[model samples]
Target: MVVRQTVLVCVLAVLAYVGLWALFSGDETETPAAPDAMFLTDYSKATTGSCVKFNGPGENDLGLTVVDCKGSRAALKIGTVLPNTSGECPRGDYKVLRDTRHNAALCLLPNAEPGDCFEIDTEDIQRSVVSKFDCAAPRVNVQVVDVAKESCPEEAELGVPYEDLTLCLRRVR
Candidate 1:
């Protein structure tokens, strides 16, 4: 009977030690959760009677027609004025406006008219534009989307026609 009790005690002690080790050693190997989806907004300048063109990182150019232009926004669609693209923007199927000299483009919903422009903060736009335009490299004309009125505050002073705009972009995941 004593031997049996001794053996049972040893087994219980070993189990307790294991449980304590597991509780204290922090052996959890689970990865941290990824961030939630985010949207970045930006604005584009439209030329009168000229369709705004957007080129994807893969060298596909998309054209968006300007139905009506207000102070800073224009209503556009894919079939109404935008030309068919061999390959469309990876973001979605809609018309987006881009600068003639810039690689960054604004993701606008179909038929987005002036004053109907959705508001987006600055950081999101920067991340989205950098991801979409591949601005990580050096290029003669680095395309940058303006999300804040103050982002390019000096553009007006320098005689550049930059405008305040917004965009919505999700995380790549």
Candidate 2:
């Protein structure tokens, strides 16, 4: 009987040690923090004429240039943002779809897809007014241009641009 009790005690002690080590040693993997939200601004509100331009932080300290005008939609050669790796699958990892527009291009990634709803991060939206315009002034009718993918050669194509790629901007009261 004593031998049985001694063996049981030993087993229990070992289990306890393992439990304590797991709790204190931080053996569990720590989760990564979520990437910050991104935002968009209305091109109309920033510029007076038909065209509006903006830039942002991207991969390799390179920036992205967005040009929106009456009938033209082009994305200039800007830097890429570091791909998000916080989740099991990273967001923002993208491939260029094509290059045809002057200083403009298209890209494709899982995060940016058609029908994927995302909240805009107002704080991330930065602006430089190349031309000043009053918000209340007559708003120009701008049509977002959809570049043709066929113009790009098969090898140069990245992926189809999201159908709804327009930056949805809301006016602040």
Candidate 3:
């Protein structure tokens, strides 16, 4: 199933690239026009499980770069949030990374197992096309733990974070 999804994503990526290429002229320096309303969705408003570039933490107008999970720079995937957010992120793990004043929640891709540290890249990141190659590289390791109903299991260690609902975690040094 994963293989099929990977293949599908690859095919879709190729198609999207071809479409984008056709949208541009021969000038490599020419910037593509801003996306139309039909294509204005950003990472903050993307669907759950959608892979997105981890552009450090901020709530500025600099929109996120959404991409295929198979692609690189997919440091995080969108997670659940409170309802009625008007497409903005809610109070959650992603909100912490993004700090205050923004609505977004994300978890390290692949839902790290208990006591496991996930590696991610956090340097020289900016708005750009993120590729699968980026996922092959990482800069730091952080631990993740899944929480339920805002509470950890009795056996789970203490932490002070939350993501959507079933997940609150602390980054292990």
Candidate 4:
């Protein structure tokens, strides 16, 4: 019985190896071509100044899509890109996205602009994603007066500090 079992196992192993070899040693199948540059969605290659729509932390999906800076879908700008093992983004304010599989980190800046309005997320201030809206809109509670300026004007009710500058905001509520 032992001899029969050993012979059966050896036969099965030989069959498995032959099957795997036959599956891989094929010239009939053509290798797939590389994807086009425009269709590539890898955000790890994004550089400073590139605008992106990111899926922030705590969300089920985590990735980014590069978009036009002037477009409404652009939520953040790449302040800088670094390795996942690198230090934090330069102090002030920034949303950091680290992709462990890719070994990359993206320092993102809010894509806020003058005349744009936003709704603040109090629960997680650092993860508060900004989206542009009309100042007169009902949900628009904060309006930007100036960005990256020498200083926020005295008339501005709130001054949100950011990298190298301050965003002068006025209460819309």
Q: How should the candidates be ordered by lDDT, best one leading?
A: 4, 3, 1, 2
Regions more than 4 Å wrong, model 3:
1-45, 54-63, 70-72, 80-88, 96-141, 147-150, 154-156, 160-171
lDDT of 3 by residue, 1-173 (tens): 99999999999999999999988847667787754222213324556665555444533434565655554345445555323334444443343223223454333233333444444322211222222222223533344455466677654444434344544345334
| Weakest ten-residue segment in model 3 by summed lDDT | 122-131
Report the lDDT tens digits of candidate 2 across residue range 31-146: 87643321223211221112212344332223333343322222122223222222121222223322222333332221211222222222321221112223333432111122
TM-score on alpha carbons, each prediction: 0.24, 0.23, 0.36, 0.66
Sort every candidate by TM-score, greatest first. 4, 3, 1, 2
Backbone collision tally, model 1: 7
In candidate 4, stretches whose alpha carbon ends up further than 4 angstroms from where it belongs are 1-43, 55-60, 122-124
Worst 10 residues of 2 by lDDT: 43-52
Q: Write the per-residue lDDT of candidate 1 for residues 1-173, one digit (tens) a residue.
A: 99999999999999999999988997569887743321112223332233232333321434333332332222222222222223344333334444334435443432232113232222332222221223232321222223233333333211112223332222211
Q: What is the lDDT of residue 57 in candidate 3?
A: 55
Model 3 alpha-carbon miss at residue 37, Å: 19
Worst 10 residues of 4 by lDDT: 34-43
User: Candidate 1: misplaced stretches above 4 Å?
Assistant: 28-30, 35-163, 166-173
Best by TM-score: 4
lDDT values, one for every candidate: 0.34, 0.31, 0.45, 0.70
Question: TM-score: which is higher, 2 or 3?
Answer: 3
Output the number of the lDDT-best candidate. 4
